[model samples]
Target: MLLKYKYKLKPHKSQSVIISNWLEIARKQYNYRLAERLNWFEATRTPVNACPLNVSVVPVEGIYQNIPEFR
Candidate 1:
């Protein structure tokens, strides 16, 4: 079992402003990471009903080729 605790914070005006700025930076970083992860997921996924199996049949020099750097 695990126990969690929460505490309220009371800060001076300057401290409050600094904390707010830090929170904003964190929020932006979180949003950027989320979008990057979503884009990577979408790019790597193939449609289930794609015709002619379009994702396959790549040339030897194509991006999908078995390159060591890609891994």
Candidate 2:
């Protein structure tokens, strides 16, 4: 058997302000990372379901391959 306890936080005015600022910073970072991922996918033309580091098939010289089909 196990028990879990949960509590809500009630911060002071200054603490709330600090928390709000941190939340804003976190949101900005999240958006930046999402945009970076989108840009990488667009540039590489890779599917979101495929792993970026998997390069099983080596391309021949002077030959360009499209994004490999992934299951």
Off by over 4 Å in 1: 1-6, 48-71
Q: Across residues 1-71, which tens digit of lDDT does each residue of candidate 2 receive?
A: 89999999999999999999999999999999999989876766767798767553445642556556579
In candidate 1, position 40 carries an lDDT of 71
Worst 10 residues of 1 by lDDT: 51-60
lDDT of 2 at 48: 71
Over the stretch 1-71, how does candidate 1's per-residue lDDT look in tens digits? 99999999999999999999999999999999999989877876866676544454456588746667643
Error of 2 at 2 (Å): 1.6
What TM-score would each prediction reach against the true structure?
A: 0.57, 0.63
Q: Best-fitting candidate, measured by TM-score? A: 2
Q: Give the Å shift of residue 44 in candidate 1.
A: 0.5
